[model samples]
Target: MSDPIPSADPLDDLRALIRGAPGPDRGAVAAARARDAELTKPAGSLGRLEEIVEWLAAWQGRTPPAIHHPLVAVFAANHGVAERGVSAYPASVTKQMVANFAAGGAAINQICIAEDISLKVFELALDVPTPDITVADAFDRTGFVATVAFGMEAISGGIDLLCLGEMGIANTTVAAAVHYALYGGSAEDWVGRGTGVDDEGLARKRAAVEAAVARLDGERDGLEVLRHVGGREIAAMAGAILAARHQRIPVIVDGYVTTAAAAALHAIDPHAIDHCLFSHLSVEPGHRRVLERLGVKPLLDLGLRLGEGTGAALAAGIVKSAVRIHAGMATFSSAGVSERGVH
Candidate 1:
């Protein structure tokens, strides 16, 4: 056979990584299923919880999966699009919120504490906001790739489960633009009143999304679309997703902004995000469309639009419980319980 594709460019390397991701471990899945059959509860009574256990096993390549060290990583950045009045809050809010995360005062902190997951906040150059998407590309190729690499590094040490989220003013608008470019939808189909923007602000967001995509003139290469419209935090989240697949770590992706990041990778290859489980169904209208296109359902539907990884952390709690039940529950033999339908 001829030589495989070369990765002379960083974006080319990213494409290779996505395409080369390993598939689920069939042996691990079989082992998990065998154990599930021995549990005292009726077969499949645990519903998706049982499936979650198998999923964790298949991804972690182990018989019984456990969440010993789950992480909630939230990347924060400032978007130049915020200057267009697409969000109710100013760009300064991005930096302030990062501070809030650091001070342990944000909702994400409380959720992580309750769920026993560690939280890390990455602030991507608050002083250097991405270029306004309506007028220019969001990031040059080098900077974008570097940011992605930084995100990949976040999956270090002994993280078995990763929950990805973002904090960026006007990133929802950036996400809408990227979605429209990648998915060929109208601006309204992707735009939502993020951060409680009023009617006029919503109109501005739609127009900004429209203008940003129109500037692309139909450029739909996943990385190219991201380079043109995706923000730093979005790129980082995408990188985290990619890295999680390579490391065999299961990921719980947060709401719209984070989902849009995964959607970019999904556009590159339909199965690029197979390792990621969406955390929740955001009230944001675009999120449902993205999930439908990806052919996956969220773990919860608390009408959450907050973007600090709260939804993903909550989902992590459920995943933790699933693993606990699968590993901790007594087996039929051990408990001396009679099997169902035994004569």
Candidate 2:
């Protein structure tokens, strides 16, 4: 049978949407700031939250910002490297967790319901299988560019906002391996105690990363490392970020694995950074390094290590607050209050 034609590029579609989207109004910002100064509190007493609200207004190109149809897209998959005894959890956990997510038993499901945000899950052919996870358009390529390109094109939908998460056992090994290959560091530099792996398990995990790197020498680009050492979910997340940038939708990235994927995407297109929001700092040892490399400051640092978009889901509340404050707060003139804190 002939292969089916691919759909229109989501990134291109997104760019068109953003081009037509309105830019923030300076008049609205001035009014909002003035009203914020008079909001029955000391000027700037609300700290960064207040600033976040103002920034949201600007991002939405309105005096009062609103986020309509916010979306959280979770990508789940398993890693082939799990067979190497690198992770504390079994590969079955990937399928089980995905089932939990589908059944509303996962943290992300509950959070999304509580927050009233739309959630969609994709399963890449990393390891686990889910009926809902959409496959990428291109076949898996052995080389880097092809693999990254395949991943990037998979989920380029015109989502309003995106959150990246992964669910692969031993996938952290793949991330560390990618890091080692890209940074020329020892596995020890990127390895961590993923999912409560004991010291010996951690050592084994580190060895797996080193092995993957050694197995794919001279493959230095993001796509090649991804094909050789990256998980399917990671690759998909990288693609999703690229699509989000092309669509001009902000992407909220979860912990170490997802951030590593983001790094790969940024390597492909630096402009992608402008469309990203680092959600939280994960307790994973390598997460900080990855975020630092990306020059991103997360909105929160709650010592979280859960990988199923849990951190990003929690951080979504903050984004919601920013939107609400921007759209709901009264202006100084509207409230008949003096803008005494003008500076």
Q: List the residue pairs that clash in candidate 1.
A: none
Tens digit of per-residue lDDT, candidate 2, span 248-274: 456678888888787765554454555
Prediction 1 global C-alpha lDDT = 0.92
Q: In model 2, where is the ten-residue run with the lowest total lDDT?
A: 130-139
**Candidate 1 TM-score, C-alpha based:** 0.97
Candidate 2 deviant stretches above 4 angstroms: 1-44, 50-63, 126-158, 341-343
| lDDT tens readout by residue for model 1, 1-343 | 9987666688998888888899999999999999999989889788999989988998899989888999999999998889999999999999899999999999999999999999999989999999999999998889989999999998898999999989999999999998889888699999999999999999999999999999999998899899999999999998999999999999999999999889999988888888888889999999999899889999999999999999999999999999999999998899998977432
For all candidates, the clash counts are 0, 7
Best by TM-score: 1
